[model samples]
Target: MKVYLSVDMEGVTGLVDAEDVQPRGRDYERGRVLMTEDANAAVRGAYDAGATAVLVNDAHGPMRNLLPDLLDPRATLIKGRPKPMGMIEGLTREYDAALCIGYHARAGVLGVLSHSFMGHEIEDIWLDDQVTGEIGLFHATAHAYGVPVALLTGDDTACAEMTAWDPSVATVPVKYAKDRFAAQLVPVPEAQAAIRTTTHQALANLPALTADRARTRRLAVRWQNASVTAHLTAIPGVLRQDDRTVTVEADMPHLYRLFNLFLRVATAVTTNPPYC
Candidate 1:
């Protein structure tokens, strides 16, 4: 069996501050080590569960956060950006299951370092009117290729959110969020152990964990500022729903591409200097 692992930074063991996730932060190195170890644990678990191959995708800022040299030798790493598929890149029908590591809750929700895709640029994302986060978005993308999300590891809120979506999905909570940047953490060793155990169990039950396909997919993105909507409206098939929201009707592949484009454009506009 083959497994795909999408790993992010914020929800890794003991990470409760945004600074820890950035490359320039004082604790950034420590954060990377923790992220790598957690991922290694998951990779180890996948192998233990009879997985013949595993691909680990670094799905955080810049998409190059994971240290390739430090990663488990058994799994191949997918790094860098500009890929058509963001988190679930390289995913296809050949994979038996997908594992989401170090994911947080949706924007405006309580989770350790929680934010949807872009922190301040996107306020919320809705799929068929359901409030969806990274987990929902990436899970849908994986599902499109017939890969089931068997295991997820993150903070308490992220685990709760995933459980609500699919009760059978195995989840390991590395921390309990007091707020966005504050959390009651699980020790690194414990978190890693939990992730390994849960991953093994999840893969063991892969047949039952496969997700059902959505009948229809309509993605609605609500930006934090109205200015971001101006850029998105220019995309073909993207409709301006309101000053701060845009809606797109497409399947998972197309929708994922549009979302990637949306993030690039929105990030560019939001970071540029204003001209009066």
Candidate 2:
């Protein structure tokens, strides 16, 4: 069996503040180590569960946060950006299952370091009128290829979000958020152990955990800045919903392409704001 692991930074063990996740922050180095270790734990768990191959995608900011030297030797890593699928880049139908590691809750939620993709730029995302986060969006992408998201690890709110999206998915909550920047955390070793155990169990029940493809696909992105939304409306199929939101009508595959395009445009506009 083959497994794909998408790993992000904020929800890793012992990470509770912005300082830990940013590259120039004082704790950034330690955060990278923790991120790598958590990913290694997941790779180890996948191997233990009879997976013949595992691929790990660095899904955090900069997309190069995981320390290659410390990553488990058994798995191949997909790092850096401009990839077609962003977070779920390396995913394909050949994989038996997928795991989302170190993911936090959606933006505006009470979870450790919680935010959706592009923390400050995107206010929220909705799929078919259902409020969803990065996890849910990526899960939908994986489902399009018939890959089940068997295991997820994060803070309590992230776990709760996944459970609500699909009850059969196995979740390991390494922390309980006290607020956006504070949490009651599980120790590093304990969190790693829980991830390993839950991953194994999830793979064992992979057949039962398979996610169903959505019958309809309509995505709405609410931007933090109205101008960003206006800029995105330039895309052929994107429709302006309001000053700060745009809606797109597309199937799963096309939606993924449009989403990537939106991210690229949004990032560009965010960094180089136009004077009104």
Candidate 3:
């Protein structure tokens, strides 16, 4: 079986606050290793579920979180920013399934390390008029490509949040968020075990969704910070809603690419400086 994994840093084990997730931050290196280890656990699980090949995308900021030498040698890594699919680079209809590793919920979801792309610029997202998060948007894109999101690993809120969008997608709760930036730790080994178990369950019940269309879909974002939203909604198809949320209509099945572009524009506001 072929599987595609999208890996992010925030929900990885042993991480907290921006210091551990930001590139110039003091603890970012240690957080990166933790992120890589969690990804390997998912890799091990995918193999157990008969995944013959897995491609992992470094989905975090700058997209260079994984240590190449320490990654699971059995899989290939797609690293760097400005890539075609962004977080889910290698995804295609040819793949049997997809997995999201170390993911978190959108901003204000109480998930550990939770924040939408470009932080506050993304207040919320909607697909087909239903409120959604990055996971929902990603899953929709994967579905458009004829792939099922078999497994997901993240904080309890992340797991709970996904349950609403995809009840059947296997989920492993590696941490319980006490609040936005804090979580109760689950031993590293324990979290790994939960991830493996849930992955097996996910494989057993893959959703029967068709994936033979010409990558057409819509993704709209609502930004809490109006200063940023004003600019994004100014794009041709983008419509500004109220003062906080900006709606962008995109039909590209390659949503990640569009997502990458939005990140830059949303952060262009002078008041909300980037890297602060």
Quickly count the clashes in candidate 3.
1
Q: By descending lDDT, how would the candidates be arranged?
A: 2, 1, 3
lDDT of 2 by residue, 127-243 (tens): 999998888887788887788889889999999999998888999989899988899989889999999988988998886334344555999999888988888888898999999
User: On residues 5-103, what C-alpha lDDT tens digit does candidate 3 reach at each position?
Assistant: 999887787776788898888999888888888888888888888888989999988999899999999989999977767777888888888999988
- Backbone clash numbers for all candidates listed: 0, 0, 1
RMSD of 1: 2.9
lDDT for 72 in candidate 1 is: 92
Computed on alpha carbons, the lDDT of every model, listed in order, comes to 0.86, 0.87, 0.79
In candidate 1 the C-alpha lDDT for residue 259 amounts to 92
- The count of residue-pair clashes in candidate 2 stands at 0
User: How does model 1 score by TM-score?
Assistant: 0.95
TM-score of every prediction relative to native: 0.95, 0.95, 0.90
Expressed as tens digits, the lDDT of each residue in 122-169 for candidate 1 is: 788999899998989987877777788898899999999999887878
